[model samples]
Target: MDAKLLEILVCPVCKGLLHLDKARQELICRGDRLAFAIKDGIPVMLESEARELPADEEVGQ
Candidate 1:
C-alpha cells in the first residue's frame, strides 16, 4: 500500500487508525475488530465486505 494512502485510511465505522497486515493483505481495524480485505491492491472498505475479527484473533503489524 502507498504510504500516503495508508496514512489517510481509517476504519469506516469507528474512524480509527488502521494497521496494514501485509502478510494477510488486510487493513485491520482493532477498534472495530474488523479486517478489510485488500484485493488487487485496492482496499475493500465497505462494512459489509469487512470480516469481523475473532475475539482472540490478533491483528498483525
Candidate 2:
C-alpha cells in the first residue's frame, strides 16, 4: 500500500482510522471490527466487501 494512501484511507462504515496489515494485505478498522482487503494492490473499501475481524486479531501498522 502507498504510505500516502494509507494515511487518508478510513473505514467506509464508521469513518474510523485504519491500520494496515501488510502481511495479510488488509486494512483493519478496530472501531468497526472489520477488515478491508487489498487485492492486487487495490483496496476494497466497501463495507459489504469487508470481512468481520476476529476477536483475537490485533491491529497494528
Candidate 3:
C-alpha cells in the first residue's frame, strides 16, 4: 500500500484510523473490529467487503 494512501485511509463504518496488517494484507479497524482487505494493491474499504475480526485475532500495535 502507498504510504500516503495508508495515512489517509479510515474505516468506512466508523471513520476510525486503520492499521496496515502486512502479513494478512488487510487494514484493521480496532474501533469497529473489522478488517478491510487489500486486493491487487488497492484497499477494499467498503463495509460489505470487510471481514469481521475474530476475538482471538491479534492486531498490530
Candidate 4:
C-alpha cells in the first residue's frame, strides 16, 4: 500500500485510524473491530464488505 494513501485512509464506519496488516492484506480498525480488505493495492472501505473481528482476536500492527 502507498504510504500517502494509508495516511489519508480511515475507517468507513468509525472514521478512526487504520492499522495495516500486510500479512492479511487488511486494514484493521480496532475501535470498530472491522477488517477492510486490501485488493490490488486499493482498500475496500465499505462496511458491508468488511469482516467483523472477533472479540478475542488481536488487532496486530
Output the number of the TM-score-best candidate: 4
What is the overall TM-score of model 1 with all chains considered together? Answer: 0.94
Q: Residue 5's C-alpha lDDT in candidate 1?
A: 98
lDDT of 3: 0.91
Model 3 lDDT per residue over 1-61, tens place: 9999999888889899999999999999999899999999999999998999889987776
Cα deviation at 57, candidate 4, in Å, is 0.8
Each prediction's RMSD to truth: 0.8, 1.2, 0.8, 0.6
**Residues forming the 10-long window of minimal summed lDDT in candidate 4:** 52-61
Candidate 1 C-alpha lDDT tens digits along 12-61 = 99999999998889999988899999999999999999999998887676
Candidate achieving the largest lDDT: 4
Error of 2 at 26 (Å): 0.1
* Candidate order, lDDT descending: 4, 1, 3, 2
TM, every model: 0.94, 0.89, 0.93, 0.95
Off by over 4 Å in 1: none
| Steric clash pairs (candidate 2) | none
